[model samples]
Target: MNVDRRRRRIVVVGGGVAGVEIATSLGRRSKNDQSMPAVILVDRDSAHIWKPMLHTIAAGTRDISQQQTPYLAQARDAGFEYQPGEMCSLNRANRTIGLAPLHAPDGRLLVPAREIAYDTLVISVGSEANDFGTPGVQEYCFKIDSRLQADAFNREVRIRMLQSVAQEQDLSIAIVGGGATGVELAAELMQLTQIAEAYGAPALSSRIRITLIESGPRLLPAFPDDISQATEERLESIGIRVMTNSKVSAATTEGFELDDGPTVTASLKVWAAGVKAPAFLTNLDGLESTRGNQLVVLPSLQTTQDPNIFSLGDCSSLTLSQGERPLPPTAQVAHQQAQHLIRHLPAVISRGKRPPDFNYRDFGSLVSLAEYDAFGSLGKYGLFKGTTIRGRLAQLSHAMLYRSHQARLYGFWRGSLVWMVDRLNMRLRSAIRLD
Candidate 1:
């Protein structure tokens, strides 16, 4: 297909879930027609993985290999071009972007920084863990914000487990952030110890100490109080200590020192507390941003100052009308925003018009608390006006979120087949604890 013949050129930055979704959808829509716009996906990494699954990888229940999709392969299959490089700056006035130098580990320059022109630029460069300017966090705490960070935490966990086994001592893990990531990681760590013991890792049966620290009064501050209570109870039942109203004043190599001056030492520390837009985004010329440095996007997902530039996922602060608060940085919200853009972009490209306001629909929330089970609220049901499920049902629902995303990218038939295959693979393989 002569995609270049089409006047519209769409450039999507970031290879995470949002970037891939938008690129894939545009490519699929343009497949049999040469008049459709060309799509290019850009990111520093060559592979794409679901950001929501990083916590599971850290806990060692799921191997990172199984969770990642090669960007080259996906681009080829989806009919889009894949470009590997970090974006240095965006120039809305010139309709061009600045690219950073690409280098090899041996210090050889590969691609000299060059500008890429785009009729429409979609900035989906996802957010990173918010340090809140906390002291020692940059040097000490492990964050699961990216695949690299997740891998680092996984390695630390394995090495610590080995050392603990060698010394015949308990393995201690401290997780900061009581949100979904923190709660999920705490549960996954417990499962990892069980899986490790099955694999004959010495002294793995002893008490595994895990502390979940949250600054809020309860876990899952985003969810309803009932759901949060259930999640807290479930964690405590599994012997995972839940500490609410606790703040990490500083992180040391030894462990986290609490605000009240109590030091909690651990073999590993994970920071999942909050998210902030990447620092580079703040410097984008003429773009209005939030306190967290997220690009301030209008209801239509376009930046207020630049209609040609769009952003979604955790990177943009698009507020909802109901609560007058920015939408939570979740996978579902990003997916929904991408779907809206898929429908709206074609018109904007072809007719030289912008779409009307777009609003987000809340699908409730789900939190998977390791193998002891999952708990959260689902929006579809009528019981209590919002049905809350825990245990196996909740687990199935939690798994389905990824499946739902897969279904949207691929069709239902293909997505279902992949899901079944993955389930079977999990059954056959000796579980490798990544956390």
Candidate 2:
């Protein structure tokens, strides 16, 4: 509780982008120092995968093996300890976290519930697909909130494609939510269908039907209207149906039941609607949170009630001056927050002074539709400020975003090597098939 002392131990919750970024930054920042905090990263998964690329995995465009980085390896390489345990509860008063017992596949307990004390804490447990309390959604719909969930959906798509080919019946696929995830997934599904047909599943293409259901007026509601319209046109050209202003009230065994009293039958159902922080965070002690269950944090990225506890990414909401609402849940925001905290956290750790406020820049948005096309706004360019671009340039720019994150995480040389490796792997491997 002393201000002028260094933290002996620090624990970072969540192994996603934000957590890894913060942990890696802390290691880099404290490299020259003799006395540094021992950093421990706690996550439920054994490996880390870029959440933005989940759509590609589900579409079979990118293999999970290629995209995934082992958390243990990264932690070891980055000078941190990795703990593969879920955070069950947080006792702020005691400065300890209660970890849930980890279980083996065979139902045996691997690790018992344990407590870990920390001098500083960072919670970056990312969000999950919110069903908006739709009836029967939890039971019937496939949610692409995690790698495991994405894999399951991909497998189901493969099975359905095979079934369609065997029976010569239409294989209907329905995607709920028209945000980036839903739009990108629709595009990926189209690509996967093409690949399946080219790879000895000719009958599959004719029977494959993709439908996007959005409760809003257009797809990519976060972007400009022109970009959204362009995406809609591209989807239509590829035989994917776009249903706007259609809300899914419930999910039945076969498909989604619409709020307008119509049932859309599909062989596979995907729920990408909205995002909400994990429910556990909402009821955690007296921590301040928004209506959507996101932890409310000051500009310094510290929780309102406790300066020892910091939060970032989708798990936390920081209001910005440019926008009336909180910053949108995007990888760019998380990456920026990580960079901001990395620069200022040392002062707070040593001097007990709140760091300078962080400002989030609006760098525009990009949406990729597989290999077909990409479109987005660049947010004030040259003389044409607030101009939007589309086609190849947009696609290239869209990909660079992921590369930028990799650059920060793996550094310049290693990140470039990994990027080259990904390209080589893509060329060497055969195109993935849906069947």
Query: Where does candidate 1 clash, by residue pair?
Result: 58-435, 59-435, 60-433, 60-434, 60-435
Off by more than 4 A, model 2: 1-7, 30-32, 380-385, 433-435
Local accuracy of candidate 1 as per-residue lDDT tens digits, 1-435: 234733578999997778899998898766655677888888988787788888888777887877777888777778888888899898888898888989997999988898878999999999888878889888888899888778778888888888888878777889899999889989888888878888887558575699999988999998889988988998888778899998889889888888875888876778889989888888698799888889999888999999989999999998766656788888878888888888899889878898777777776788887778888686643544477778899888889888887786667898888789788879997677533
lDDT of 2 by residue, 1-435 (tens): 111234477789998888888887776555446366767888988888888899988888888887888887877677777887999788989999989999998999998999988889999999998998899888878988788788888888878777788878888899999999999999999999988888887667778889999998898888989898999999999989999989888888889888885788986888999999988888677899987889999888889999899999999988866667888898878888888878887777777777888888777788899999898887643465578877889888888888877887789999999999989978888777333
**Candidate 2 TM-score versus the reference:** 0.95
Alpha-carbon shift of residue 203 in model 2 (angstroms): 2.2
* Model 2 weakest 10-residue run by lDDT: 1-10
Error of 2 at 58 (Å): 1.1
**List of clashing residue pairs for candidate 2:** none
lDDT of each: 0.84, 0.84
